[model samples]
Target: MKLSQLGEFGLIKNARDIFKSLNENIVVGIGDDCAAIKLRKGFLLIATTDALVEGIHFKLDYIQPYQLGIKSININLSDIAAMGGIPLHALLSIAVPPNISVNFMDDFFKGVKDGAKRFKVSIIGGNVSSSKNEFSINMAILGEVKKKYMLLRKGAKAGDKIFVTGYLGDSAAGLEILKRSQKSEVRSQKKRKLIKRHLMPIPRLEEGRFLAVKKLATSMTDISDGLASDIRRICEESDVGANIFTKNIPISKELKDFTSSQLKTRGTHPADGSSKLITSLNFALYGGEDYELLFTAKPENVKKLKELWKNVNIPITMIGEITKKGINLVNIDGKAIPLTKEGYNHFKG
Candidate 1:
């Protein structure tokens, strides 16, 4: 059945059935004027909202409705994670065209339910509306962190060490492969891995929480907008500068293979590995939506942080250092290049 047949009220009922709150703190969930939840005393609430629109943030050709649903929640959850908070509840609002299928909606909601379950978040309330042409999802997530454990982007100081969790550029490379595959046949294990990274980015919630509770991070931000852009944000907010060492930036072997394959397909010299490496580095620096944490800590905390992080198993690489005032990227040979805001820009034409 089409959404047009079920109508808005029926859709609401379906959503309510699928997303019944499991948390005791949620006094009221769906079917109410407003969702209500009890917050623990001495904790500060953190709220973040993110929207994904068809043809803008995503394309239905490559992304399934289920993946879209999960992506919507994860993106907002990432924001809360960046603030070092534990996501507790969410409000999901979606707009769909009349012709959208009931099964598609079901799959989408199933994804949402699965994501909420994995993250221990409750889908407490939401709204669904008709769209003229495109499908869109707007998710508002609410989380909490103890006042002393709250992390912000404005706390880095000069001489701090900058670190990023996990490898970068796989998502962007995945997206590139997806776009490329539409016109050409691209098949490989690396391609699949990269695509998975783009489709299902893992929010570093545990890492963020550990950093916050341990007071390990002086400043933190999630890499939704790529390292170059996000690092610039931290610098701007903290009134400091950064020097990122190109050699220290982490890129997975899978991503390197994908980039090499792409370059070879473009008729680049097979033996010119340097160009391929440079291309991969570009993706690592500017590719957005990795959803990894980019954080800084005082130089002195480096040893303790690494010691604590050993058990977590997430790869944390010290890619840079907080400088006194300007953003610069130092190459392998110590050539300092001026860095700019080159990440995703919603308004950039």
Candidate 2:
């Protein structure tokens, strides 16, 4: 059946029923934002796995096989990071097309090995196979968190502030570059930044560990499906609402610079004048694969989180707040406006 027919929640709800507890350690299973398991030595084993296919997740044209292998592994680690867990080990599984050379497979594993070294994670065991249409990599992460420290997706409370790490939309920009492969023509700076953004997503592994150790996040999820979808997941899980100021969103200057150049050079203006630039920003908001961390925190903890991780990659912005009802995006003038989700979906192009 079509995913749209079942819908997101409906599909998960139906498929989740088949997820019988595999581990004796599983205290809480597939339903919550993060899986929970009873661990032996005061740890909760938090596991997350994500797979990237050539066409669906990425294209060979934009990213190198080495980086692709690294990302396929790092992104799962990003999930572990979102839960504020210490990533210990990972399992790699790959299916390469017959056209892919054996040397290419070696390079891919080398990239995976390099990624494991960077994250201080070990490679256990994994499967490799040949595919028909595309090469795919799936990595399963096994991490441990203090029982009390595992961040959840459903713990946001009303009045809590919403925050995300780093700037958004570069990944979308990268995809744009991939789409418009005519590198000879003048490309905007923001589009260049976007290309880089998509190519190398910095997993917030250290920051996630810091968040767990510091006890800063109330509920959390990574921005895999852009800010809009992931934030909506948190709200749905918590049965709470959120409010983020459009002005509060942190736009990377590089992104701004590149996109501005594109608009002027191409003579493409936004529907409402300059706000047409919102497309790239919306890509940042809804496009998947940024892999940054998004979490909610009480207003009281804002000062502490700021002081705690000041030296981190980018500033954390309180884009909106957790509301009691539904997700609401307000304009700079305080008018209520609906944010059309422009993020990626697996089945939907």
Candidate 3:
């Protein structure tokens, strides 16, 4: 049945049934005017809200409703992780077209429930509204961390070393493949992995928490808007400059192989591959939604960080150093090129 037939109140009732609270701290949940939760006394509360809009942020044709639900929650959880906080509760709000089916809503909510369950978070309450054309989700997440463990983007110093967790460019490349897959008939295991990375990004919560609890990262931010833009955010907040080495920037073997294959298909010579590689590297530098952590640490902490990381299972690479002032991308031969582009811009198109 269409949402227009069920109406808003009936829809709310169904959602309330689906999202009954698992967290005992929630005193008043879904049917109430406000959700009441007992905040732990010793920790600081951190709240973040994010919105995903159809057409702009996502395309329904390429994404399943269930995956959309998980993506929404994961993106918000990433915000908490960036701050070294543990997500506790969430409030979900959605505006969907009345023509959408109830089964679609069920699948979407199931995705939300699964995501919350995976992270041990409670969905206390939310609002649902009818949209004329598009579907949109806005999620607000509440998290907490000890005051001492909380991290910020402003703590990086001029002498700090820069680091990133996991691989880069995969999501962006994956997105490229998704856009091209409709026209091309290329299917490979590497292609699937890249697509999965874009659709179901894993937030670096444990890694972020480790950095916070151990006081390892001097400054940090998640790579939501691409490394080029996010690193600039860190630099801007810390009032410092950076020198990122091109050779030092970590690229996954999957991404490298995919790019080489594409170039070969286009009949590009091996010697001309550097130009093509640079284009692929742009995806790593400027493509958004990698969801990995880009962080800075003191040089002295490098040894300890590497040692601890061995146990954590998250691969980290030291990409560069915090410079005295000015952002430069240094080549393998030691030529410093001024970084000219920022990451994905919503309003710049």
Candidate 4:
């Protein structure tokens, strides 16, 4: 059953039936000229949009339609999470070639439904168009947050402590493994966990909200573009600088093992451990799409923040501190090396 046979109306009807929503905030959902949503009083409305295109963001060989659906929604939700907002509704837009199978769309929507359901988000409406060759998906997510609890990229001040939630570079390392297509590596459970992280990044909504509601975070943003690049955003927005301690940056055990294996495969000995460590550290610093929360907190509140963070399951690490000037990475021996933005750039070429 190809999409060409179903035509546009049939495709939309299928979507309407599949994405039925009971969210009370939605005054009008799918099958309307415009989906109407009622904004809650005393809360600020937050909206964000993102796109995933074939060949650019992902390849069909490496990702399934279902996983693609989940990734698309999760990425957008991350923006909402960064602002300490609760997601309410979504508008999904997709363009596919006419030859695309109906089953493909069904599985994709199933993934979207499951992902949205996890955060209590409703799919209100979207537009479908026929593309010539490639597949593209774009999602606009709507959320709400109390004015007092809303967090932004600004407000980080000098001497504020920097923190990140969870491990970094797992997604980029997973992407590396997928591209290598090593049969043995793919079979390992540890490697599969990396692949899962790359495919379906978990948004740190609870962590973001906790930081916002407790007034713990002075500034915050999700690490979609890697620490090296995103930390610059905070510095630029807040007009401050940062000094990241290399030893404090959290690296997962699996990532260390993966880098070690790569060196061994290249005929390098474990005796030259510095080479392996640097490789893994580079990934933690420059690899994009980690989706973890990168935030700053005033030094005076660090004690209280740490005490309250015990209630959260995910671990938070203090990686660095806000400085007066210059973005630098401080080595173990206290050498400060200037850092650069090496994360994802749409027009780098």
Model 4 regions lying over 4 Å from their true place: 182-186, 264-278
TM-score of 4: 0.95
**Poorly placed runs, candidate 1 (over 4 Å):** 183-186, 264-278
Residue 120 in model 3: lDDT? 91
Residues 1-349 of candidate 4: C-alpha lDDT, one tens digit per residue: 9999999889898888889998787899999889999997899889999999998889988888889888989999999989998999999999999999999998899889889999999999999999999999999999999999999999899999999999998887787778768544435887888888899999999899999999999999999878998999999999999999999999998888887787634321112212233367777887778899999999999999999999999999999999998999999999999987666777861
Give the TM-score of each candidate: 0.95, 0.81, 0.94, 0.95
TM-score of 1: 0.95
RMSD of each: 3.6, 9.9, 3.7, 3.7
| lDDT by residue (tens digit), candidate 1, 1-349 | 9999999999999999999876899999999889989999999989999999998788988999888888889988888889889999999999999999999999999989898889999999989899999999999999999989999999999999999999998888887777657735667787889888998888899899999999999999999978899999999999999999999999999988866665644422111112343367778888788999999999989999999998997899999999999999999999999997777877871
What value of lDDT does candidate 3 attain over all alpha carbons?
A: 0.87
- Candidate 3 ranges with C-alpha deviation above 4 Å: 183-186, 264-278
Off by over 4 Å in 2: 1-40, 182-193, 264-278
